[model samples]
Target: MHNRYSLKEMFFEHLTRFSAILVLFFLSAIFIVLIIKAYPAIHHFGFSFITEQKWAPNFELFGGLPAIYGSFISTLIAMLFAIPVAIGIAIFLSEIAPKSLKSPIGVSIELLAAIPSVVYGMWGLFYLAPFMRDVFGGNGLGLFTAGLILAIMILPFISAITRDALNTTPKILKESAYALGATQWDVIKDIMIPYAKAGIVGSVILALGRAFGETMAVTFVMGNAHQIPSSIFEPATSIPSTLANEFSEVDSELYLSSLYLLALILFIISFIIIAFAKFYFLKNRVKRKKRLV
Candidate 1:
């Protein structure tokens, strides 16, 4: 029976190792494929493809700056709006909310994440866009509107993950803090947040990553305008939105390749952001843990 258990453990270890390797293999494959498909545009446009804002296919001129700018700005806006709200929701649900209210509120928040992206797009287009236009004084569709929609779409994810993180804090720690005459805010700020900082950071990064890649939800409100937006209320395009809008309409090889290059650029951006968070942030975390040990 001991031998049987050992064999089962060994098998499980090998299976999990294989799964990790498989994920790496898939990531590498996608990068390789994107590079291959985007090579022509890379070679033709050189580095200017990233800096130029023009995207007129009629003139066969393609530049990714507008899309890149829009993507980053929209994501920035989303993170700005979502992070604080998400953290507040997490704190409320984990620490402040009464048990009777927690279940209903938690379920409603989680339900937001279950809604389809296209549904968000529709709602943003018809409802949110008009509201923004009326309130902020711009055409219905623009970066600000898109960013707001992205914030709402990503809120549930960030809140849920952060709530779980905050919940992981020990009851004993809170009790001790209270016993020491610490106020609720003091315990939360000094004890709970410090203890769960890693998870909180992870949740924010996850939401940021999702906001970067959000396509449909952004597309409806962003207007897919291929130009550098002069204002937050001005219409603009993002990488994913550009790809979604023009992929099927490309009439030439260069057009297609440029779109592929845009995809590659987006892939690189997301990979770099996530890799930095995982490697730099998490490595520092490990080093700190070792020092503590």
Candidate 2:
């Protein structure tokens, strides 16, 4: 006999559809507003907004190159610092941690990620910033300090996601590695890490996205100088920090338009990272399929 559709499941499915529509609506609204506000600058500057570094508005000259550069560099530094620590945490929790300790430790790490970014900003400003300042001999308000603070802030996200990914690997896959007489390190290095590399990369991308867009946290710790920094010790400004710092107080309409263009660049950066993550995910899926065959 043929089964009829249940009203409850249909209702739930409609609810999920509504939820997705709401999310898309919100995303579209943000993008539309940003583009609408950004068009004046995009029209005026053409392609120079991305390539020119001078941001002064008095001469009718504004550019976002430095802000773009700073955001990229700081996020890069933070991701580099966070990746090793995150991987280590994932390895420990998923591979080596005592069974009894796993749940508590994992929960604590997730709790860290739950902390507000503004709280992190305040902590960085009051505590971590000064500590790094002292350690670095009064030159701490730079990419290094901002990146380090961001690294700590993003650690939980990267670690939690990675540990979850690694933990999801089939138990028999690990057992087979052990059955082959592989050492613990060999099993992890050759078997587990390679298998979960996609998820690990995805986790790292999530953390990097957070670092790239974090406004209050980076603004508080990073010296808000709108210049390209050659050394990590030199003070600089990220795109988000620039918007946070000056968006409200800036006077000219053109000036505000420039900020919107910066926002567009930021949106593009996020889009690129998300695209890369999806590409990697698809590539890994194909590899996994080949392995299964």
Model 1 Cα lDDT, one tens digit per residue, 1-293? 99999999999999999999999999999999999989999999999999998988999899999999999999999998999999999899988999999989999999989999999999999999999889888787888898999999999998998898788889999999999999999999999898888778877887787889889999998988999878999899999999999999889999999999999989888887777657745876887799999
Error of 1 at 82 (Å): 0.3
Clashing pairs in 1: none
- List of clashing residue pairs for candidate 2: none
Candidate 2, residue 205: Cα displacement in angstroms equals 1.5
Each candidate structure's TM-score, on Cα atoms with residue i matched to residue i, is: 0.89, 0.88
Q: How does each model score on lDDT? A: 0.90, 0.87
Q: Please report the candidate that would top lDDT against the real structure.
A: 1
lDDT of 2 by residue, 25-125 (tens): 98889889999999999999999888998988788789788899989888998988999998999899998999999999999999999999888888888
The alpha-carbon lDDT assigned to residue 125 of candidate 2 equals 80
